[model samples]
Target chain A: MKGLDLNITIVGLGLIGGSYALALKELQPKKLYAVDKDEEAIKVGEEMGIIDKGFISPEIPLKESDLIIICIYPKDIKDFVKNNIDNFKLGSVITDVTGIKREFAEEINAGLRKDIDFVFGHPMAGREFTGVKYASKEIFKGANYIITPTERNKEESIKLIEDIAIGLGCKNVEKVTVEKHDEIIGFTSQLPHVIAVSLVNSDNLGVDVGKFTGDSYRDLTRIARINTKLWTELFMGNRENLINQIEEFEKNITDVKTALINKDMKSLSEILSKASKKREEMS
Target chain B: MKGLDLNITIVGLGLIGGSYALALKELQPKKLYAVDKDEEAIKVGEEMGIIDKGFISPEIPLKESDLIIICIYPKDIKDFVKNNIDNFKLGSVITDVTGIKREFAEEINAGLRKDIDFVFGHPMAGREFTGVKYASKEIFKGANYIITPTERNKEESIKLIEDIAIGLGCKNVEKVTVEKHDEIIGFTSQLPHVIAVSLVNSDNLGVDVGKFTGDSYRDLTRIARINTKLWTELFMGNRENLINQIEEFEKNITDVKTALINKDMKSLSEILSKASKKREEMS
Candidate 1:
């Protein structure tokens, strides 16, 4: 709510953290502190001037900071949060940039004290390309920031999260439950990547067809080049939504296969027509 | 085959036809001719020197050409071929630039007189943009040209078609049955378009998202803004393959959905991991 002069501590100086650091620099935070296990990341962040202060270890530095944003891989967030929760000052508002939520939410809700405002958030933008060096202050421009809040979260925490998103140059910010966020992303984002990867794999790309591919082949399989550890963890974390979205594709494809097998022109036309119309309407 | 001096004529002067005309001219065709119902297309092609002679109608010019390449919309090809088959010079090759084949192969093979060779070929290269102005002589660079030959066709005719593909600057020329060509394209090409159209149409594309789309999104969805009439006819023509491809997608997606619904983390991880590996192996 107030101007972001609040001391902001960002954990994990990866692409998201580095970008957040650079983004908040324009706002002139009272003090910006970054912590990461990777000294190289911290060193890069400092060299790039993404943050004012850096620490190699996870000690919650001077927890009186107004906000603490966790920017780490989804699987690591829980342990990192556990390590830092005790040192977070009593009134500090905490948030995260994790792709998945339920598990992280449960961990944070149960791990941290009630005095700390911890609302989970995800900024839905990034290249398959990763790391701090690739980080840009402008990457967040016009990207969506979804804030996951529960009844347990204080209203002020949600406001602070929204403010942080807006401060980071996010064009749109909306409040959503953890479940809703996971489900929507599964359909709109994560599942698409899965599909892309599957299509590319099935085509036996990387060797021959990769060079011959036109724009369509390239675009559809763009997300195939992923950070396996992070994605596998995310898929496992958001297992429910991922499975559902994949199922939707499966059912649609099966019906299509049946029509093809039967040589049912009408059904085939109707199917693509419906998909086309739906796609058009959504656009 | 003999330096392409066989009275080469192209019907429809859009990107494909115009490019083909330009390529033929470079090969020193006997008398390059262009016919299009669009008077503007004829004027433009003549002015651009893509073709030496231009005709506003197909009927009169169809009698003189030794080889006629139909570059019209798939829906219009049947009528165009039917009306012009009687006019085609005896012992000449009649080919098409349509993406779909089974339907075309059946009708053209059965309908045409025994003298003319009807070999269906498709050069898998195009831009989202269209028209004679967008036609590039270099569009076919490194692209695949599929020659769909039936058992009834002569090897000499196939060789002539192969030569045309090479002359167009395409190197990956392969002979495939109509069914196989449709099947392979249905998965590798058509499905990508469908996915792109769906993804693009999903929401009002923020200008920022558009800017951040990178090469992958651009490449994948390049065919999104398609020529609807042509694509519609192509889909119907190769209904079997299209349906099968769609079904494959459905199955893949369904597997994903089940993984999510049941929280089957292992299955989801394996699928994503395998898919990523598969894509990495591709070109």
Candidate 2:
């Protein structure tokens, strides 16, 4: 299907869904639609001209959409797919924007309609702010997009998703296995959130430490103002991989602490320099 | 001791020193002088009009200046003070911009010339990039300035430093004992660097994890491209307090890890919510 001729529908009009609607508008789909539980979100999205139409019920939009992007909570995805199994258009492409992918991919692939193409995707972009009101197309600009494709997916479906990711201003589109996706996301996405939360929680100073903070503290904890319910679900969903990543991080912290206890400046300097060199290579 | 009539000399023209010179220029000091072992740094400061004169030796400027700001490595501050003890003009105010303050304050207070007043101050601002070339006066704008005073410090000298801190555009000028300053800094400054370095070093995915990163990972590790030599000195000089802070942080990480391992969503949600609340309160 040609990108410009397809009808696209976004489910859940929160930050990610709303942002997808705004960004996908650039493709000028034949019709852009959104199905959100919140009437305010749908009204706002339509009023903002991000979507051509909005629906509180998914049955109508799902039947017409050539491409459907699911942007709800991870735990609710299975039910959304199961409940709407009969509503989806025949031969339509389905994608998701969830952080964890392994279990969802397995469950959805096994139970999904054989005529539908479910290509799992994760757009690695977000803001600390939540809701449709804060959504912007600019979040995906120069961001990474990951495609975790299963054997059930077709070549054309993956290509269609990659093309859309690029159209949304992604700088890189890399393919990985569902397992690889979960493990890497455990480190790159989930671990950073864990660390930021822990760092903020560890503050024991009676006085407001904010007055004494520099760029280091502020930058490090910028994401500590988190979405609690969503992140808890993300954390529990990928528990094993996240636990391993947390252990590795804790061991590294122990190494630094041991060096500090021994007053071993040589080991300390080596560790810091290695991290510095590695970080420099990243950019 | 009036601001307009006083001559100010900045010792050791690195990032902090160069920035002080640039910001202090707004006060239009009778003469702004800089002394540094790096002749090129002094030359650049003078050529950029951040300072009126550059000195390879501290003797001339130290003898004439009424207020002297020392900005050098933490380990070298003692030696610089000892060597330049006689060069300081009688009753001139002296200050420093080091991260750790307890040990330096004690040693300097016990051995300082009775006439010269040493008021220990730490400007809570820095960039990941180092040296005079990257220096800008804007770093201190709305930044925190901390003054840690001992019994040896004169009230007038502390007041003068506060005035300069405000003149340099610091949002807050806070006073604390040396012990309190070091303890709070260990939590606010050193612990964040330790966590950043550890987070970068903990990357075991083997693949280029950078491609998968979002704002959370990038923001948390921005300081991982650290000034190794200087930070090593800082981490070691404040070893005890830093170790305590690290242990506290490790405990919090363990709590999250345990919650994940147990699949206790209630505990996980509460932890994340508390952190979110605390972080929201910070801003």
Candidate 3:
């Protein structure tokens, strides 16, 4: 259970995986290993000293590691786990850093070996850039970490994951039900991405819109440069909650449009003031 | 029309005005004067050496200044210019930093003194914080500056404003028709604010959503702490264009929602990819 004494393996060494490997290196684990289909990423991780060793497949690393951290697209999680379930060492703890939880947790736990435990987690931190070369452990500093443990999860496994999250410099480690996690994330994460993408795609200005943009426009659309295949998986996996969030946002946009069209300055002012107050409260 | 020798007067000593005053100090104008009904802002401006003198009324300052920069709300531009019509120095150049332009330009030009030229402008720079105390000229460094010169504007007046914009550290000085200015600002500036306000207002999550948010949500909602009164005027002043922009954005959002509802991963991925490519081009 000691963080520094355990052997750790990271599956999928991209931005998140590379960052986790870099951060976990600080814990001084006995042996830090990584599995990535992209051999270049694994080679870079080893060169950067982020991982002690690298593997193209999980068979050998999974059997020796005491903890396995999977950092891959949400759609690939089930297949990855199901295909490698037998390779995982008995009594080892497993966790993931995907955006969605409920269904993935249920599917994985349904067929998971009783001796191996999977503690679901999500670290609320990332950059617009991709790849292992862009990865840094600093992204985790002061970030929020969430754990969604199902009924079958053990306290010891949850505690182990929490300890690692804290060791990675997370500011808050909160536990929420899988349903609540998805619902809140729908509002806080998915909705913002949807809005950013929509804003960018709504570009009708023929001129270089970048020249006319201020800080607000720049910041709002910063994430619009998204990873297509990955986000498609996420948007579809958490379909219902994300749709509800988008609809709620659409309703708000309608309210503003109506007030503007009717020249109801009073109503528009109130809406803006309420939003301003709410944003201040968040700070 | 030497930059350092001219007498400059900044009307309405709020965030934009105060920042302009501070930036203009670098030019070391012969005299820097600011007028604001908020006498406290004027006093602070004078004490901080941002302005050489302060005035409660524009009458006296307007009579002597060679350059006047009006940084007031969009709705007040006409009234301010009307009230001070006879006071402006003969052949002196005047400009403004309001978000909207077309109507204000026409209305002010209708009864404006022929000798005093009013060159319309909009600085593509701002902060969520307000008032003279929060103002910093650094906001203009690398920011865009737009000039919407009407038919009545003299070439010399437009050149003077452009020079000052460069002196103030603006990265680009673009000239566009008043109508074009409004159209572009609707998409670049106003639409982002509308989205930020709407996103913050659509808070259905009962939980403290801050803990669950990542950089994307924080960046997207940062401007939700808006100046409600000022934005109300800007939103209404540029009503039609902003409405069109919002409708366009809504259509894009609906595209995303429809794709999600039908579980059309390919279409959704295409939409996201298009947005991502457009955003990358902007960068």
Interface RMSD of each: 4.6, 0.8, 0.8
Q: Residue by residue across A16-119, what tens digits does model 3's lDDT show? A: 99999989888889999999989899899999989999999889999999999999888788899899989999899999998988888888889899898899
Q: Across residues A21-84, which tens digit of lDDT does each residue of candidate 2 receive?
A: 9888888889999999899999999888899999999999999999999999998889999999
What pairs collide in candidate 3? none
- Please report, as a residue range, the 10-residue window in candidate 2 chain B with the lowest summed lDDT: B1-10
Question: 1 or 2: which has the higher DockQ?
Answer: 2
Query: TM-scores for chain A, candidates in order?
Result: 0.92, 0.98, 0.97
Provide fnat values for all models in the order shown.
Answer: 0.31, 0.87, 0.90
Give each model a TM-score.
0.77, 0.97, 0.97
Give Cα-based local distance difference scores for all models. Answer: 0.73, 0.92, 0.91
Error of 1 at A56 (Å): 1.7
Better of 1 and 2 by TM-score: 2
Residue-level error in angstroms, candidate 1, position A171? 3.5
Question: Which TM-score value belongs to model 2?
Answer: 0.97
- lDDT value, residue A37 of candidate 2: 86
- Interface RMSD (Å) of candidate 1: 4.6
Worst 10 residues of 3 chain B by lDDT: B1-10
Clashes of 2: 0
